[model samples]
Target: MNPTRHAVSLGLRRGWTEFVLSLRSPQDQGFYLFMGVGTLAYLWFNRDTELEGTGLLLPTFALPSILGALIAFGVVIGPAYALAMEREDGTLLRHKALPHGMQGYVTGQLLYHSLGLLPLLLVILVPSFLLFDDVMSNGAAGWATVAWVLVLGLLATLPLGMIIGSVVPSVQKVGTWGMLPIITLSAISGIFFPIQAMWGWLQAVAQVFPIYWIGLGMRSAFLPDAAVTVELGDSWRTGTTVLVLAAWAVFGMLVTPRVLRRMARRQSGSQVQQAKEAALQWVR
Candidate 1:
């Protein structure tokens, strides 16, 4: 088979299998519960505490702040770090023995881990309807825009997560180091705070990251006449964050499989002793 066909068939088949097996793992359950509670708590308190002024719609602060945290901190970093750990403990070796080996295994692992976000999304959405007593009022256009934003956000952040998973040297250090990126990205993305308040250069710096666009998209979903549009020019509305994220996704698409394969081979052949052989294979 050609390389393209081989990768796709393997990736799809692997994603499905990994997704299923992941659900059976007890740790997956706890992950969902913890993330779900966080999303719910943020949505519930958001209206009363931070968004009381907006009235009848999700405030600019709510979606970006809340969803940003849910997406970046938990959905993005959690799986990436978890996968990193699994690779270290020799669990990934067992995966490499399976059909389609590490590529499918890692892809599936990401999708499987991201499943926690589904319930978390629902948890946050429900409270917005019940407690906030408000709707986006953006109608079909608004909802469609929001969905695309969310999808783009997912696609963009996912690759970065994979890259982080692949590049990070050890799972043990993921918490110590990984959490910093998650938290810092969350802040810069303007998920928990306003980026516009920062200096122009700081805002420019924030623009270099994905959190900014993701937060803007979330805010646009609720804010009427927010002038949110995607362009590639110097305009702030050019969806730079989403585009950067898409680039990362492409980067992830290329890098993650190679990294997984290398790790898998190292795992199979004894990583420390066979590191050079595995790394060479990965580059090829």
Candidate 2:
């Protein structure tokens, strides 16, 4: 087998193994439960409320947008934290010593994080259908849209996480460098409210990021045609969503490897030791 392919295969296996382990881990289980329960509770409380004009139930409008936000949040923050912690613990350095190891390592990270979405989605989506009516309006076509949007959203957002991880000085910094920015984006991206309600410039800023497009794409999938009136331009802008997400995916493909390689090159025993010492001190 070609060396890169072999490395990729190994990476895929490693990712799968990690994901399986996470499923069994109590900590991960708690996280899944918390997110699922929290989201369901929010939707449930708002179940009876209707959108001011559309007469659509709040849950019907919110579920898909929440899904999109979660996708962007999970992919981006999960990888960022993983990469940062692994870097501090010498994982990156260990991988750097092997032939085509980085490739495998990256492959593993991508697969692990991507698979992580399933349980999260299932936790929310399964109950959502039971708790809310018309959560999925378009049926088969809606599901098809979901499939494509999810693929594109992952491509677009996962790399940003990796890049943030590769660049942040330490795992602790991920909150400021990665999490805060994404949270800010989510607030402006129409996850909780309509984007059209924001100022014109803020709307433009929100549209520039993948989170907004991801949420928009998701809403397009789960929402009926009439829901478009609540969206910007009073349209789902399906073509624009596709183009924007694809653009981000392309950017990530072109940029993430270079950023990772540069970060990897800088890793050394001394740096790892320093990080460990710093962590110990912080813990103290």
- The TM-scores, one per candidate, come to 0.75, 0.99
Candidate 2 regions with alpha-carbon error over 4 angstroms: none
- How would you encode candidate 1's per-residue C-alpha lDDT over 176-278 as one tens digit per residue? 6677777776766566555655677777777776676766766666555533322123243635556676885677678766766665665654663354455
Best by lDDT: 2
Report the C-alpha lDDT of model 2 over 166-228, residue by residue, as the tens digit.
999999999999999999999999998888889999999999999999999999999999988
Clashing pairs in 2: none
Worst-scoring 10-residue span by lDDT in model 1 = 226-235
Worst 10 residues of 2 by lDDT: 127-136
lDDT of 1: 0.62
Best by TM-score: 2
For candidate 1, the per-residue lDDT at 151 reads 70
Candidate RMSDs in Å, in order, are 6.5, 0.7
